[model samples]
Target: NDPLLGVPIPEVTSEQSSSMASPQSNVQTNHPMTHHNNKWTKDHPLNYIIGPLSRPVSTRLQLHEQALFCYYDAFLTSVEPKTYKEALTQACWIEAMQEELSEFERLEIWELVPRPDKVMVITLKWIYKVKLDKLGGILKNKARLVACGYRQEEGIDFEESFAPVARLEAIRIFLAYAAHRNMVVYQMDVKTAFLNGYLREDVYVSQPDGFVDPNNPNHVYKLKKALYGLKQAPRA
Candidate 1:
């Protein structure tokens, strides 16, 4: 009787079952628990334990198990870098930084210029992050070159510090309205958000570490758009 092919097991006779059912009965019953030996699978109440079933696994079942393991293996993710120095040493982090710089250039976030006299040039730092999917698997590595906005003066760098953010109640109301109208809701991801906001103040920042140009080592980046760390970035 093969278990893998769903073959039915041979049922014991009613007379043999009655003898095995009684705990006080001393009569022996023909219950084939062991394979041709009485060395294992004892019928004692104290020592009675179900043993491993001897079954044949088909080739298809073996392949399916292998495929299941491979599918879950994709969720394995790498660790995030702690600093720019650590990030520069790895190829994956270098690619992430490159992607960030490319987006900045595409958006015309800053322009290269000589260091202005008596001007406060903010230093930039590389922020490393591991972007993950909903299932917790790594989607990609994220790098952001952010300005030191803490050095910014209230009136000089920014005026009003405010960003329009939706409230919890407003979100709930919107969801309720959408449900009432039978709307199909979809999420839109804004990759480079603050970088797209136009900057009113002339914010100058040092070139990103590890990617500093040899030709313009003393040059600073005059920001044309809002930076990540800027107080007025979300407002802009």
Candidate 2:
């Protein structure tokens, strides 16, 4: 199911379907241009590059075709809005921002207050991405609000950062064991998981761009929990 749109996937006919069981049957062959035999003598400049004798020509042409095929859906995510104003120009982006902000509010991630004179407030930015299915179909548009942690001074804003991440070998071993046991692995993601981490440092951030509080436009948010892009977020 498509999470963002909630639209049912369109059914494909058996002839169009390509699965492990019948991979060779669905392989693309007999291109239209190849059948037409466009004029290009062996000695011609174009023929020298893409003639039947060119070993890499087929690979290069396939790559070009794949890139052209992805052109439409790639724009759905590869082109990201740089600012809140830019994002508002698109309805899908606006909805994605709203959903992210609502999640932050529900988690009680921060408190709005007057900015302290001496403290430096970290800036926030929006990031956009498109989620795809196993078969490379667009599934959802995802938006994330992240702090500009790169601007953070090392000793002042953070002490140390570390997080537990799986190693490839360990993952492979686990998968092998699972397969040996004839078990299915179930995976789940904790949405906004970073917000659940406790923040030890006194971190303050500028209000999120699009969802600023109307009553306190000048105020900043004092973070009680770790935010995405914070230096200590992964460790916290």
Candidate 3:
């Protein structure tokens, strides 16, 4: 017999067989199968693979496109005044207030007799700004003559300056109620919102800047109606 061919396979001992029957010993023997099963479980069909694979949809370009369109529209169609004269002419309503000021002067709302013995006379200034539409187009150039309310003393110049205004929630509830009642809510805006009200206190202000009368430079305006920047302007 050839020496290699005659060599016999060794039989497993009883100790070895007993060890193989234990769970811990079986783990070493089944290591490859265990690893394969773990991999299969991780890649199961029901697993949420898209969670790691998916990317967030980008909104940055959409916002940039909207912004570019807005900018283009404003550049092409905006109605801002090219010259100062055009801007001043757009505020012609300031001239109308001169008549009311004259009436207030006649009523002697504030003593022009002289500034009070020691008390300071509150000065006035004209404020100018451009009103714009929702689309960023200039609608009008508005001019307002206002008292320097900062100079006014709370107790001496005004009393109880707080005024009630409709809250946003109240306005929403009102709109809902109106809708339920089948009411059509019509909106109207007063051209001069403040000019509609008469001033209860004797309020005097310096003449408005651009629209002051050429003849009367020294004459200060005695306000007959509530102006835009009075300390105690009515909310209504």
Candidate 4:
């Protein structure tokens, strides 16, 4: 919901521009018969044809272009790799991972500690998302490393799991009131919001995949603040 949460739009390079334009010209000249078959021909006796299209029908647009035309399914189908191994193959996801870890370090969310005995250690995984704008432009590529909170023991690791979020009906009512009162309504989002909360109970989690310290490969992170996917994170 945050305005800034989106995949970074890539700059159009001269090579890409030339490549995209080259296909349209070639397709028009080579596929005359294809266009002839696709042109409108009305069935009703009284119906008449409209003027020809101003330009030749373009070769089918690329997936991203289709998405820009508001084809939701086309946008959704854009490939997103599932695992760290897969994500590393793409530059976008690699940058996303770097940004996430940088934020974690900036927030001082946790500290590396020697793995303790007799206590359960929760695992973590990376979640990949391709955030888009209303018009279907990529806004951001997000990679979140979240704890496996379901593995947590309720009595020992977490006791509460409650958090408040804005209700849609409530938001509508507030907007209506503001409109009637001739007041502007503004909204704000807290980046890393959950991490702002202090954790009451000690929680230990395994090192993130691909980021384990070489010297402390067996060490775990002792969380001082709530993290995403922790059951008590919202309540904290």
Every model's TM-score: 0.62, 0.60, 0.47, 0.62
Compare candidates 2 and 4 on TM-score and give the better one.
Answer: 4
Go through the candidates in order and give each one's C-alpha lDDT.
0.81, 0.84, 0.59, 0.84
Any runs in candidate 4 off by more than 4 Å, and if so which?
1-77, 166-184
What is residue 120's positional error in candidate 4, in angstroms?
0.8
Tens digit per residue, CA lDDT, model 2, 1-236? 65769767788877666443565566566744345556544554653464356454346689888888788546745457776787777678889988998888898999999999999999999988777799877687788999999989888999988886999999999999999999999999997889899899999999887677898899999999999999899998
For candidate 3, the TM-score is: 0.47
Model 2 score (lDDT): 0.84
RMSD of each: 18.2, 28.4, 19.1, 27.2
Model 1 Cα shift for residue 16 (angstroms) = 70
Going through the candidates in the order shown, the clash numbers are 0, 0, 0, 5
RMSD of 2: 28.4
- lDDT score, residue 150, model 1? 91
Report the lDDT tens digits of candidate 1 across residue range 153-173.
898878977888999999999
Residue-level lDDT tens digits of model 3 in 1-236: 67789689999998998767666654666455634352323455645444553444337798899899898756533344443344444334344345445644654444333223444556766555557899966775454456678877777766757667789999999999999999999889765565556666666566545555676665665556666667777642
Candidate 4 overall lDDT versus native: 0.84
